[model samples]
Target: MRLTALLASLALAGCATQAAAPPQPAPKPAPVRAGLDPSFELDAFPSTYRPASSEPVAIVNATILTAAGPRIDAGVLLIRDGKVAAVGRDVAVPAGVHVIDARGRWVTPGIIDPHSHIGVGSSPGEANGDGSNESGPNAAGIWVEHAVWPQDPMFERALAAGVTTTMILPGSANLFNGRTVTLKTVPALSPQAMKVPGAPYGLKIACGENPTGGGPGKPGTRAGGMLGYRTTFAAAAAYADQVREYRRKKDAGQPAQPPRRDLALETVAAALEGRAKVHIHCYRADEMLQMIDLSHEFGFKIAAFHHALEAFKIAPVLAREGIPVVTWAGDWSGYKMEAYDSVMENAAFVQAAGGMAAMHSDNVMLMQHLNHEAARAMTAGNEAGLRVTPEDAIRWLTLNPARILGIDGQTGSLEPGKAADVVLWSADPFSVYSQPDLVFVDGALMHDRARPPERPRSDFELGAQRRPEASR
Candidate 1:
């Protein structure tokens, strides 16, 4: 009995000792990155975007504009698992799915802005409002996402305008402005939290007068601008060659020192490799042609040309090259020599010539009415004896911009296997009086006009409506 008691006491004492000791920390998880290329994957800046809804939802009896297909009258759209499950007139609503009646309403895929500077350019006339024009003609090392202020009030205004996705780019102050970031227009604390998952990085380039300051050692002319691009690209190509050789030698079990990384050259190398889409801020048609030549010289493709005032002149060329033109709807004329040729029919002419044309709002005020802007372009085209349908105009605001950002497969159109970014309108989406009654991002009801609180405001704008004297 003494031995038995002694053994039990020993077991209890051992258990107590084990419990008193500090616990071991769990092993850190491996980093998440898009690829094995160190240049692309710096850290695990994972998206913190949580969908507001994961359950099945149905929006029925509405005039649906699929963006990718013909419009459906009295149609039904289905959402499940944060994606568009099905969309058409014959789509059946399954049991237990939350239904949104749209008997007298219209439904369309959410709008996409191809060129914008909402987050990075915080406010006009403010000291820190600019994104990056810091001390060099070539500042490709910086990324616009890093400069994004997610709490910018412009994002909420864009959401109110049915802008589900936007490409926030650096201003065209440098020859290479930097990387552009695509984000979902959801209210979030961090830019990473708002990043559109799997979206391609965009490299902003410039042509014509933007980069030329006519100063000493500056790209004062178009010829000098081309020379600047060529010199920088040659250096970048050499760096890329050295890096590739190092990787090759290492893979073959040879000891080789890796080349020192240059962030500016790294961005340029990515563009040369066709990993980053090129967006050039060009206006005149001649400059556009010169840029096309420059792209050929560098062996990189230009994905789109923003604010191409003379795009109508090069519509056929752009169409043949498979490059998109992102331009304003009717905001043109007499601002500069380059801006003099801008016509309201630029978008229409581009579309008619078999090129993708998107109506982009370069200004903050213009972005909020992109649909109306598209309407004006459509009207101009129709009045000029062109056949521009409402569906075609809707595509200008939706699919074309999505294509420009290289995210058409995900959220641009109302199709199966795409993200359920949708908007329900109180009337025809193009109508000036029409407003979004409900907006959804990735199957989540992000904004409902009936609920005022659903519309989010920025931290800076909190209590902004009250009289300043009273608050003080």
Candidate 2:
């Protein structure tokens, strides 16, 4: 009996000691990123998200770009319920509204990135390999929304740079890589919380040599990538037809046979039905032309051609077809076989042809400097005598991409009845010294150099890396 009691007491002590020792702190939580990541909980839409506030927000005496007309001098914009309530030279300042003096500031819609890899833990290579391509020829069903980290530090940096909205996609290793997620840069612990309310869904497609792994032979060849895309879409169309028939039967009060579900096919069907957008990754002019045909065949619109290094060569045709090119300011590369024809005049040439061109950054580090990207494109345009004005360049980062993402009506410019996604520039945005003095997303002041947030690290960021003091 004594031995039994001692043994029981020993067990209790051991268990208590183990339990009280902190349990290894459960391993430090990774910084949450936005985009295709699933664990970050960004998927919590909860049926609806209404950005309403009791108080009104007002910005007075700022130069505003409507993104469709001449700059409004001495403009006043009022925001209520997280959207632009009014804007004009004649809007009266409401009594109970919060107002800011923007006497010498420049205000435009928050910058839009048609392509970015922010919010996902893209580093520590092995763990995040799933988020990128470098895989097989096709991973169409891999949805990147499963991988976004809402707390990604890039979100704040981009806010500081005037980026409020972005499309996060998986890498272009596969012909049909994954479904893209549009995100609003806000403090959403889950991916659901970060979604751009009412934003259209988009699927990521690639063409040219990108899917061929920049190598030789088979799917490692450009032709193979095209074949793979066409074949996959054909399969998706068949799959969608099967389901549509089932749905029709159910609606007709008949015995409806259930069809197998495929996430990949569902995304493709959404595009075919005009419920989704298609942003294809193509760097060459020829591939861009081919993709336009694919869109024609699939009965969908190609929203934009990402990283179209040779977009200028086909700008006229792209414009004629009403396709937008979200590309880098310059070729920025000449290494790949298809990329050999890239030129410094890509942006200028495209703009001259009346094609919609937007400067996009797929790099996490550059997402914040979209203005600089536009400026780079502007410089190239002017050097080529293309007459691309700074105001016009602003549209590349603002209105053009917004239209591509299908959010032009609500948050792309300084229009009344749009979301109050505004940016205040310290100088003319085209100047090298210009910086975002203030940034507002959805009517909330998110970045103020004079006052910053408590925690600025992204959800994907790990360890004790401190926010830059200058940034803070």
Candidate 3:
């Protein structure tokens, strides 16, 4: 039988079974109005991250770009107790602080990538190692962090490239894949240790070809995909209403039946309640507009649209809706029908339209050179007669992504009160020849190119090396 026909028959069988079942009474629990039920625990895997120990260190005589404003030449940045104590040209360096004269070097806030799949889709791709997606279309109950391999060697590579923070997201195979976890680019034994404490979780949703491409038992067309989203969200709305009614009855001292918990609906309800941020993976302009309308219908805000290749086509609309575009820096297109209309100036166009724009590394290889990506975008924008500056381009990799991940208040720019996540470059960071000489996360020295790690940070790399055979 054809796949579509088989799916249709299964649906009919499910409907007939539901109709033939007799109506059952709802379970009534003992009336008590103290608090919510114990089964509704949202944060079952809370972050246990703690900043690494660091001492007072002062970096002097470097050109600094704060990502918040103009550049500072010959400036001094002081780090104390894992925080930026002072940063400017006239800042005084105390006697006890360890000072390094970074002559001819550049300093900026550590880079942050809002979209990445490094740990979940770890390197040397083995069949058993890949855990970026589940079997079904809607796996909203699953958390990507649970599948994250803390030993992924890419984490240390990204750290060497000045990536201080990143969000490990599920792949875009399903319509509603799972939750996203934000992590600091620090070496650790577990995802919880790498996670950025107090960072809000993001729900990953996809539009266009990715979610509907699967043949059987899935949305096989664009309209079908839309229907699936609407139906699922409608169920989520009903679930929310049922929970609210139960709580209302309980508050009024009336006998109430507790609503049965559904993990998928619980995740959707959290998005509806403005607790989890909604991030969609969309490419086409029309689909983005449709998603905006859907967001309006559901009364939820979109945090960002990742891999938005055609975002330049509707820059003003996105600006009006206050949705940021997290896109690639170069013109990467034609690989798929939806990504065919990409432009190198997509990020610049969004920024020109008075909207927020940021660059992301959807590939593990690309994650190692996000600064170069920003440089490419800036060069493309400048060639197109846009007044894009190094300072502005720097924000695309630093402050802008931090804003997208909802962690800008803590670690985006070189502010006095923010976390001392800073990087010192060998030369102009935008230059291709430049490299990070020193990288710091929350004031701790995490990576130093001058003194590389002698031992592999990943356990997979430990015994994989060929041992020297004993000579006869």
TM-score of every model versus the real structure: 0.88, 0.83, 0.90
Clash pairs, candidate 3, are none
Report RMSD for candidate 1: 10.2
> Per-residue lDDT for 1-472 in model 3, tens only?
6999999999999999999999775555675433345235457788888999999999999999999989999999999999999999999999999999999999999999999988877877632355446466777877889888888888899999999999988887788888899999898888999889889999999999988986655688889889888888888888889988877876666677777777777777778878789999999999999999999998999999999999999999999999999999748899999999898999999999999999999878899999999999999999998779999999999999999889999998999999999999999999999999999999999999989888887887766755568332
lDDT score, candidate 3, position 84:
95
Cα RMSD (angstroms) for every candidate in the order listed: 10.2, 15.6, 14.7
lDDT of 2 by residue, 61-95 (tens): 98887676678889888888778888888999889
Order of all candidates by TM-score, from best down to worst?
3, 1, 2
The global C-alpha lDDT for each of the candidates, from Candidate 1 onward, is 0.85, 0.76, 0.89
Error of 1 at 256 (Å): 1.0
| Leading candidate by TM-score | 3
**What residue pairs are clashing in model 1?**
none
**Residue 155 error, candidate 3, Å:** 0.6
lDDT of 2: 0.76
- Give residue 315's lDDT in candidate 2 (0 to 100): 86
Model 3 residue 263 distance off true place after TM-score fit, in angstroms: 1.1
